[model samples]
Target chain A: MTVENLNNINNNNAFKVPENYFDNFSQEIETRIFEENIKKQFGNKNPFKVPENYFKDFKSDISAKPKSNFAKIIRITKPWLSAAAGIIIIFTLWQFLLTGIENKNNQTGNNDSLKSKNNIVIANYQPEINTVDIKYLEPEINAYIDETDADQIYEDVNEDNNETKINSDDETVYQYFIDYADDNDYTELLAEL
Target chain B: MNAAASENKISEHISNKNFSEAFNLIVNQYKERLYWHIRKIVIIHEDADDVLQNTFIKVWRYLENFNQNSKIYTWLFRIATNEAITFINNKKKKEEESLGTYEHRLSDTLESDEYFDGDNAQLILQKAILKLPEKQRIVFNMKYFDEIKYGEMSKILETSTGALKASYHHAVKKIEKFVKQY
Candidate 1:
């Protein structure tokens, strides 16, 4: 028969099914697909295996309290702790600065006190002039002056006149007399005049 | 209960400051899934255990910051994935090996691992899977093994759905070619 004549044959009469085959047909197809998938994936087996009781023990292993709780607590409090520490540091620095300033002020006070003490010491200080010894030596000096040669005395007097004139021109005669004469020297000089 | 209601309960517990109870619930809920995910990535039981513990520790430490914007499981998975990848990179660095050399070494380690119980075909398939780049390997594992939806994978991986889909497709193609050639 030609290809067009072959189409006239009905193939529906050639096939029969069990009574419930159509009922489970979709489920059977799904089961087959699942089986095929399993076989393709791992030949219906898991290639990777675990030790027996591994999963059982793993739950406890993982569920045990983590040691990082302490770290978390620290992390939570870290900012507050840092702020407190910063405040402490600033306080310490401020106190240090205050102490340094106080120390500087105390040293300045000490130096000023030392200067005042030194001025008092200098003001209270006196030289030993020995006015009694000078008073006793004056009469001997006048006697020795009287025993000198008259010409020598005259030359000395002339030199003294020139010095006195220069001193009187520049300074007051009372200042010169107070500087060069004692009390006994004035009486002897007046007697000679 | 559904994930939303369960998540709500956990969130309530956290809000109440019942951290210990909330953490226990989270650990019980996600430990197996996260362990398996990390196992596939790191391929060593010990390494997976370490990464799983680290992932949970991170969850515990950061649980207060969880705004419940994303599902808790997704957040856990993200932490687990990052921890696994970082663990691998750190191991690679510690070994002072180049990427190719490190991959080779990892393959050898898989062969010698006492915990791996796969048959020869499974081993061959695993080896084929391992041939993929790291991101592709993760994508393939999440899609094929975990059977996670693209939307969930996107959230966990912080990737776009379109990009994840393309990555999965390319990964499948590569794995298929590798398996066929093997």
Candidate 2:
């Protein structure tokens, strides 16, 4: 064989391809190119889609969630900050409870003064009885009566026979005295007795 | 049609918004040459297919911006070359392997390659080509096997013709020594 023939033999490809590769290759290229063009066009036009007014609805959806400043603060601070907030709340509530109790006691004292003011009627005072001296002796007399036996007191009163006969003279006299006491004239009657 | 007439028709069709027709014409005219050019660099049919398709897609995208004075074939080859280099670099990075190690792996891959039906001499030639540095290998493949002129290679590689010639010469010397040893 000549040098040219040898060169030609060596130039021939020893590599092989799949059956009918060349026959179908051009067709494959066309198909791929066609698909690729479609893909490029699709890419530019956005293949993904959403419902109508999607962006408007999306804004509404985001707005629908709790967006108050307080809620936001709680959400952001929930990790460790919320514990401090809870402690502050508990301490404030305890302080409020303490102050409320103190205020209630002060109001009760004021109520007593108000009741005394309302009850004082200077026009109805009895000139015969000096109620100030009686008020000064009332505490010591109550103490002496509390120390004495009730039966002994009643026996002492009965020992005054003239006073008992005068009291038993009218059977309905006890009912009249009780009715007068109910009318709030007991202070004057006590002074007279 | 002649290349000039085809370029005019493609340009006219593209200007008229007939992209599919223009792009299809471009693919039909250049797909085989681009495929082989990419295949030689990547050394795998499947990877070559991917790079070729990517090259055409880029061409289609940048068609409007194409310089009317330059030949479409030259522009297409340039895109195919860049895409092939980029693909190789990305594949190497993904595998976390250096270019030399990747080339060695490709050499091993060629042994078991079902697509490669070359005999001992052809396989040795391929092995010798793989032993060259990546840039030299590309220069050698284009000049030695594809018989592409140094000036055209300069356009595709964006290097001077002088530099490409030197690269090809060095690659040929190395391949000769390698083939002699094998």
Candidate 3:
């Protein structure tokens, strides 16, 4: 087939259509218009509505306010920056928590070993103290004394006619230190301090 | 219809405040032509119906503002053309497709449309027309199908006669090539 042969081709189209389509189309449009008039008489209320003053301010909305390039860059990057800041905060806190837990575990393990070695037999009990080691252990010993159960120790001392006054409920005056602190939250708190 | 006589009648009826009478006259005079024009642009009977109705509604609203210097049919054709183009643009935008894709979709619609009356050769011609760029398609349609003059097309499309002639010539060559291959 060539462009020259185009004039020889049939002009009639092969598309099919329903019967009386054009005749019915005019009637359909008329019906649509009648329905529209009826709807208008009922009040031309738009079934769909937009925000108040939307159409009124639509033109102004079209012309977006000019933004500085710096502001545009900030707008683009703001969400990512906030997300990174949140991640950094979480990571820093996680590292701090892990360090605290590790220090507490080491301290508790050392105290448990020392206590096992220092236990008295009571059958033929004798205590030995090394003066040089005492200097090395001074801070631990003072911390232990400050954390002692004053009520139980004082009760024992008073019943046995010793001279010490202590109140268990006064947290500032009496601190109870449990060896190993049950290896739970108390040890973490002591390590944090 | 005598363009001058109809314009005078329309103007007289409007000036006399006989709006419905004037509108009826306008519809009777232009409806079929406008329907066919819109039909070619939209390629579906239902869409043409909607656009025709909208064109009239717009004419009704803005008829008083009609510039008396131009022919009434030209003015009506211009409105019909804009309404049809707007309808297509809005439809395409809603579907999120480009104009080329939208035209292909219209060709598909032509095949399935219950009211389409064209045969295979006519369908092939329409498909070829759809493949042309939108401006050339319009130029080709007006020139080849409707036998509309370039001068009148210039007014309706707001394009120069020389450009429209060139567009129509290119469109003819492309369509001929397509038809030959088909």
**Highest TM-score among the candidates is held by which one?**
1
Candidate 3's C-alpha runs over 4 A off are: A1-193, B1-4
The digit string of per-residue lDDT tens for model 3 on B1-182 reads 66568778887766665554566578766777787788788877657765676677567545556776787888999999998887877777667896599998878877876666566666776787789987888777677668788889999999987677668666766766676675
Q: Could you arrange the candidates by DockQ from highest to lowest?
A: 1, 3, 2
> CA lDDT of A99 in candidate 3?
40
**Model 1 lDDT per residue over A22-76, tens place:** 7756655654454354358556355788889888766533323223322342354
Considering every candidate listed, which one attains the maximal DockQ?
Answer: 1
After superposition, which runs of candidate 2 have C-alpha atoms over 4 Å from their true positions? A1-193, B15-17
lDDT of 3 by residue, A1-193 (tens): 8865775564445766666666556654654454343323332221122235532332211012112222333354333222222222223234445543232113323422112121111101212211112222233333434565434444543344334323333321212211112223421221111
Better of 1 and 3 by DockQ: 1
Clashing pairs in 1: none
Of the candidates shown, which would achieve the greatest lDDT relative to the real structure? 1
* Residue clash pairs of candidate 2: none
Give me the displacement of residue B37 in model 3, in angstroms: 0.3
Worst 10 residues of 2 chain B by lDDT: B14-23
